[model samples]
Target: METEDDVPLHLKSLAAFLIRHHSDQLRSITLSPDPKLHYPLYIDFAELMNEDPPLAHLVFSHPIDYLRFFDDAALWAHKIVFDKLKFEKAVEKIFIHVRINISGSPLECPETFPSIGHVRVKHHGILLTLKGTVIRSGATKMYEGERTYMCRKCKHMFPVYPELETRNSIVLPPSCPSQRSKPCEGTNFHYVENTIICHDYQEIKIQESTQVLGVGVIPRSTLVILKDDLVDIVKAGDDVIVTGILTAKWSPDLRDVRCDLDPVLIANHVRRTNELKSDIDLPDDVIMQFKQFWLEFKDTPLKGRNAVLRGICPQVFGLFTVKLAVALTLIGGVQHVDASGTKVRGESHLLLVGDPGTGKSQFLKFAAKLSNRSVITTGLGSTSAGLTVTAVKDGGEWMLEAGALVLADGGLCCIDEFDSMREHDRATIHEAMEQQTISVAKAGLVTTLSTKTVVFGATNPKGHYDPDQSLSVNTTLSGPLLSRFDIVLVLLDTKNPEWDAVVSSHILAEGEPGKEKDEHLAHIWPLAMLRRYIHFVKGYFRPVLTKEAEKVISSYYQLQRRSATQNAARTTVRMLESLIRLAQAHARLMFRNEVTRLDAITAILCIESSMTTSAIVDSVGNALHSNFTENPDQEYAKQERLILEKLKSFEEFPDIISME
Candidate 1:
């Protein structure tokens, strides 16, 4: 054992600092009886800076040296409890590793390089952090970190270490340097049994987020190494922030292949960002404003909601139903379990069958922006394998790599040019849409990955005017696939003179200085405000149906089943769930957890707009051209009240609702 005087002055100070700040944590590890239960102690770097700035800087500037000191000091801090056991004996099996936590946002932390791409030659051999998505992950295996060998003749132990900050094999001393009254020049050495410092190790590849890169610029990816407690914590498609030492490893040496050094991060701490997607910081002031705004319109909930809805795609004038549907789709519904132990998905899929130049892509882009995490790709640009999951060989090992749906597990995936996709590719999304999971059994690597993503698809019709045919015939989409979408709105180029004049004036008015296209947008929410609100509503409220709401949905569903004609594929048991989900979403949008009859009626109207061929909604004429009215609440009340009365007396009629 090294005496107190033998320990370096700086390391002794570090150990003293550990004892002063984390005596209780150190005491727990020292007092633990089972060696197999060895756990690393987490040290926040912020506290270290407050205690000793020089030491904190030293830990980052020279992590390889300070990290070894951390392991050694952990045992030295508890001489009272650990004096009974030999230092070497105690350290071999139960050494406590110190994982330095940078604290705060990893992206903004001081010790980290700006990003994965910003890492350069100057950043190597130091502590740093990186934030990216894991596109590929390898299987866990045992890694020999350090090895010990004993001289055959002298029986003296000699430690062999690998290259600095690398995974290269350890090189032993050619001759023993031990002095036993004479120089022991033994050429052969005996390997010590059970003297290897091994731990669980895994390799993963991380690609920088596409959101951070410009268009046409491919996202950069780098290799990362996880050890000990860090292994197996992250899988493909997970967004993670890893703190580690920046290092390089030599690629496999081969006759034909050139040897190259690839940069890798040997992870110390890994934090997943999947659950943190909706963790937007909502200020108390904003929350108060939300409460006050809702209170102001207690008698007019729809009006208050319309003010926020207009913010969705303010550039595109009108289309109230489409905006409302977009809001519900983004807010989503409460995912719950039924009595049969089956999990019902809360994700609502929306399909926009529209003509060119009708702002379909604009809605898709705006929806993607509202989501905290989203992937926007065209159907022709992606395939079934790319949309789901695939097993790829990375470093000679077959491992699962996440695709688009898996990558957007907790967010949105917008597919434009939907009709350009081949039929074979479209057929592969059945399980992903309905079950919310992507199962891959390729390459003997069978696994099921979650795809809890909201699919927002926008496709043009096969040709022109086909209102007489079903959506399947018009768009060439299958019945089963059409049923998965909760709402399918059509945007036609009617070429009406009045509509064209209104749209042209709206576009031209934006160029003028004083003229605003629509006065309703004066109170519309901004992108940041809308994002926070969507995250808040999705995370805060879980609405359930009231008796009246339940009755309304059930009655409408029963009537649709009885008089099923056109759009027959759209009306099924799944439609009932869709109605409930949309109603629940509307209730949340209304700032309440209890769905009301009005919410149910609104859900029915949205369903009607998707199911029928009418150019306008029930009361509103030509929904595409409908603008904000003077009294939206009154308008909403009159239309929904009529449906409420009709639904109440639906039992006696031959058909209260029909698909004709």
Candidate 2:
């Protein structure tokens, strides 16, 4: 037991502060039946700062030392509630966690939390908060924290602790002190195993999210060590904000080796940032802005929707249909578990089969930018192992490393030149796309990793695209995989002088966007606000299909099934699911929690545009030059009336949809 004078002044003060503020919580932990179990006391850093400013400073600067005091303070506080003898029964069981949160809070600034690349040698031994995606996690191991030793010369008892300055090694005392005034030389000591203190330890590497990095800049990663309750709490692909002491670990020693020191974080707290809203905090003002924007165009809902659509990829001249598809794909539908306990994925996949120089890669890049967390890779560069999880031998230990899709678990994945991937590799993602999970059984590792990600793929057609041929023949993609996409838009670069002239004028006028008063450019949201808006709707809205919406969607499915032009593989049950998801996503885009008939009609129109097998509305045409009509509301009304009549003639289905 450490005496009052044996503890450091700063640590003692911190302990006192905890006892003052969190006595009730500590009492509960002490009263628990299991003495060997370690309990976590989550201490919010901001609250600590408010309660005790200097103590907060001490914790921020000397976390490794102050955190130990916190644990010890917890012990004394618990002892106050319980007996000293009982509290001392298991010293290792009493621990308080310093759960620092800087993600969406005021403490998230660069001074409190810095990017991985900004960590320098000066930051070593300092408590720092860093945010990144977990790329790899090591096996849990038992770490020896404290051990008792008896001096061989003077029979003096002492404790040896792991040294943080040199990879947590223990140094032997050169001499033994006798309080009676005699000092004896004790170069050797006997190890006492009975007084050992140990805890669970794990190592994980976190890479700074590429979404925050500049173009072409490689991401930086730091090794993190988790102890006690922190082990296994986070896995690969999870975004986490870790607060810990920055230290360096020496590389393995070898002949003629320089013995490099790698930066490592001894984590005091780790908070996962997997929640959609937490990824991008939508401010009240921004939500108000969205509401006001929509309110201004309420009479013309399609106009308001077009305003939002124009915000996407505004730098590009115009591909209104493609832009709308991108927006819906990002703000995906709601995921629900069916009656059979099977999950129906809400993630909407978009495939762009276009001609070369149709800005296919541009859309891919733009979509990646729109997403808060995204991974962009070309099909040729990605293998099955690279797109999914893989087990690799790292530092003589097998560990699971996340791939592109896994790393972008909660967001989007853009694969350009998607056709260049091997068929085997393409086949591997079939389960990941539909089941929303990747089943791994490789290298003696068997585990399922969540891949709840939207796949935005772009690939050029196989030579010249033929409308008469099936999608499989044109894009060389399997029908099963093609069916997974909610929207498959074809962007053909037809040489029309009039259309080309308009596109050319738009492109030439791009540099002077600020000077133009064009309505399309009037309500374009900036990248930051757009990201917040997308995440806002995705996190908050879970639109359910109205009765009318259900009937319309069901009728469309039956129509597609009965249409002579139906492709058997493409018009299956999955297409119905896709229609529902698309309708729900459209409802979200309209800022509504109910999927109305209008939302259903818009979804059907998007589906109709991609009907490569049927000639529902002009068969198929180049979507690259598709621009918003002059009066979109009237156009929508006309299309809605025609579709309703079409549905009615098939089976006398009454139209319940209203334009108002």
Question: For all the candidates, what are their Cα RMSDs to the real structure?
Answer: 4.2, 3.3
The digit string of per-residue lDDT tens for model 2 on 520-547 reads 3247767777787788788778999998
Model 2 segments more than 4 A misplaced: 1-11, 47-55, 83-112, 152-155, 164-169, 177-188, 253-258, 276-279, 513-522, 564-566, 619-621, 651-660
lDDT of each: 0.81, 0.82
Q: Candidate 1, which segments miss by more than 4 Å at Cα?
A: 1-11, 27-34, 78-93, 105-111, 150-158, 164-167, 173-190, 253-256, 513-522, 613-623, 652-660
**In model 1, what lDDT does residue 624 have?**
61
> Candidate 1 local accuracy as lDDT?
0.81
Q: Output the worst ten-in-a-row residue range by lDDT, candidate 2.
A: 84-93
How does candidate 2 fare on TM-score? 0.92
Residue 167, candidate 2: C-alpha displacement in angstroms: 5.8
